[model samples]
Target: MRLSQSLIPTLKETPAEAQIASHRLMLRAGLVRQMASGIYAWLPAGLRVLNKISAIVREEQAAAGAQELLMPTIQSADLWRESGRYEAYGKEMLRITDRHERDLLYGPTNEEMITSIMRESVKSYRELPQNLYHIQWKFRDEVRPRFGVLRGREFLMKDGYGFDLDYAGALLTYKKMMLAYMRTFQRIGITAIPMRADTGQIGGDLSHEFHILAPTGESGVFYDATFEAGDPAAAADVETFYEQMTTIYAATDEKHDLAAWEKIPDERRREGRGIEVGQIFYFGKKYSESMNFTVTGHDGTKIFPEMGSYGIGVSRLAGAIIEARHDEAGIIWPDAIAPFRAAILNLRQGDAATDKICNELHEKLGADCLYDDREERAGAKFAEADLMGHPWQIIAGPRGAANGQVELKRRATGERLELSVADALAKVMS
Candidate 1:
């Protein structure tokens, strides 16, 4: 993508309303623009990052045995009423009246809708232990929506539901999801600690919220040193890893227990603010029983299946990633989700020789790089490139281009080396 042809409206000064780092950086870097109070139009660059995050989530969910199938953004009020939450959901749910005066809602969550879908189609215990997921838009009319996408009224989400004939099957599904969440966060380049959390509106006996530690986080999180010690994905067994994670003392402020926290060694206790990126809940028959969804048992008795819901905030993750990975210059995007892996900067834009080298690099990198082919000053180009946070920056100056040389810069480390154009391209691709 050429900068001259792109729609990245990079700003020199921060927008006054952007109170958080992600919010401010996103605006200054031209990733998103506000459409309404908590609604945003994701610009090209922002959409790229969001799509990459969603892809990672889909891959992880599929590997964990969840199948993908999209559900609608709007749901019938009757579905919520069947689950006894139509009136209980409150103002957050955007209730609507259609032309025929039918009550509907922009779904904040899909528990009721998914329950209805599965109930109508799945009727036997043999087809139990099914996991379905979808990545789609969701809305929750927050009373005070702020902090960019962190507390947005509208956002993208990946919500998955699991159904099992019995508690044992549900427990196994829950463990698989826990392992999947750990791997997902790691692949997206964030250390998200799974902490005990209150289920709130989604009634459940067991719940865990995965949070990324950041000073600007909304939740006060407490955990033990062991939670951050090693890679959870490398564990040999999912059940063993799930046991280790659950047993460790980790909780958000609301669930923090002083007695349990003090039981840990003084050196092991740790506390910090954390941004919630995902959560998993095993609500058993909460939704199935309320919605009267049942499957025939082995002996022919009707029984409600145990169910669980797992969610990863797809759009909010962009803000969360920025919160966890940015520096003073701008966002330092994780290579796994960066809009472009590399950016080629033509320091002398109109110069024939410089253009030749940059165009060559751009051609070789293809869709994987952003080529700065603008007529802007060299310093402006450097600043904007840093702000965009591509993993690699290939600098093509007139003098260097004349010598068939270019400077390769590693964005995260700020390491720069002058090498032949071929050498720089090879290093970046590697």
Candidate 2:
């Protein structure tokens, strides 16, 4: 894509109202626009990033044996009433009515709906274990929605629900999701610690929250220092990984232990603020009992299946990644989820040789190279490239073009490599 053709409205200064690093950086880089309070419109660049994140979330979920499906943003109120959460959900649930006087709502979560679907279709113990998930926009009427997309009223959530026959079966499902979350965060270039958490609204006996440590976070968290990365190369056994992670001493504010914190050596103890991104809960029969989602056992007796729900804040991770990985210049995007793999900057656009070299390189590598053909100053192009945060930047200046050479820069590490056009292309492609 060419810079002149793209809709990236890069700002010269930080928007005055933006307070957090992610919010300010996103605005200054022209990634998103505020459509309304707590609601945002994703500009071209922002949407690209969102799509990249969603793709990764999808891959990890599927790898964990969850099937994907799409549910409507609007749902009937009768389902919630059957689950007895219609009145109990409070204002956070955005209740609405169509012209026909039927109560409908933008879903804050999808427990009741998933349960109903199960009751209607899945009938026996033969399909004892099933995991279904969807990536969709969810609305919650936050009284004081702030922190940019981190706490937005309407945001993208990846919610998955699992059903099984008994307590042991339900635990295996829970374990599977816990490992899935770990692998998902690792792919996004962030380390998330799973801590025992209270299932506040989701209503479950077993719960865990995935929190990424950041200095500019909203809430405090406590975790063990020993965090090993999940081996992507190895076949992940969710049950084994879940048991290993859960046994470690990690907890947020609600589950903190003073004695436990003191027991660890000073070097092994780490405390900091973290932004919560993923949550999992094992709510045995919570929705099934209320909604009467029953499946017949082998003995032909009707029984309520054990259940669990897993959630990841898809939209919020964009803001959180910047919070966790950026520096003073701008966002330091992870290469696995970057909007564009590389940028081609024409230092002297009017120079025929420079333009020719940039165009040829861009043709050779399409979406990987965003040719900055716009007639902007050298400094402006450099700033915009850094602010937009592509993984690699290729420079075609008058001097380099004359010598048939270009400069390649890694944005994450400010390292520049001078090479011929062929070498530069090979380096980036590699």
Candidate 3:
């Protein structure tokens, strides 16, 4: 799209409240605008990246046998009451009441609703081993929310639930999800290590939290070096592979065992701060039993379906990825989710030669090119290009345009190459 037509409100100075690089870069790049203390409106460029991430999640989940559907932002409180968590959930749940004075809430999670659906429709063991998921908005009322979108009050989440007939079956389902999560994160160019985690309010006996190691993270994570080199997704038998992938020592801050830490050799021990991006829990029949979601078992006796829940913080990963990948310059977005694959800088703007080369590149690259047709200074254009974090920067400067040449700068690596306009566009397109 043309730079003049887009809402690219590139800023010169950083916002004072942003202590983190991603937060500051997002604001300076005009990707988002703060609507309130803990809420921000995603601009066009920002939404593109978010949508790309969501699509990857959806594809991976579907490939792993989970059906996708969308859930509403608002839900009835009666479902929560049935699960005995209406009052127990406390202040984190943003409760509401309609004009009829009936209790309502913006759902922080969808456990109760999914349980209700299962109890109503799935009545026998024949329909067991089912998985369903949705990508939707969730609200959690945090008393002090900060870190840009990292700890936002209202955000997007991808939550999936699985149902199985027995404990053994439930574990198999959990293993499928484990592998799926690994594949999903890998596709997004993130290295998320699944570590044993505290279940928190979810009340599950078995839990794993996938964390992306970053210096300024909230959780102190300890793990073995094997996880760093292993491919959890390639397991022939998912359950067995899942067991192997999780066999190595890994734990969160609370569960970190000093004895275990000392047992590992110095060469294998690794400790670092990590951002939690996804979590999986096999809660067995916790919600199902509370909500009375029972069905006829294989032995013809009544039983509760062993259930598991998996979640990825879809919105928070944006900031978390930047936290892990950015440098002093700006955000270095992964190529798969970059808002634009490349930015065409028409240096010496309004000059016929510069315009001709840039326009040609834009036409060949299709709609993904962010052509900087603005009549701005070289410094201004360069800064904006870096701040936005396009994978490649094509400079159609006067000196090069006069020589039938253009400059291509690789943003991730500080490598610049000069080539003919034809060569440059072909290299970028390929």
Quick one: best TM-score, which candidate? 1
Candidate 1 Cα lDDT to native: 0.92
Off by over 4 Å in 2: 228-236
Per-residue CA lDDT of model 2 for 91-202, tens digit only, reads 9999899999999999999998888888989999998799999999999999998889998999999999999999998999898888878888888888888888889888
Q: Candidate 1: give the clashing pairs.
A: none
Identify the candidate with maximal lDDT: 1
TM-score of 2: 0.97
Across 18-132, the per-residue lDDT of candidate 3 in tens digits comes to 8887788888888888998889899989898899999999999989999987778888999999888899999989999999999999999999998888899998888888899
Stretches > 4 Å off in candidate 3: none
Error of 3 at 309 (Å): 0.6
Per-residue lDDT over 294-347 for candidate 1, one digit per residue giving the tens place of the 0 to 100 score: 999999999899999999999999999899888999989989999999999998
Between which residue pairs do clashes occur in model 3?
A: none
TM-score of every candidate: 0.98, 0.97, 0.96
| RMSD to the hidden true structure, all candidates | 1.2, 1.4, 1.5
Question: Candidate 1 deviates by what RMSD?
Answer: 1.2
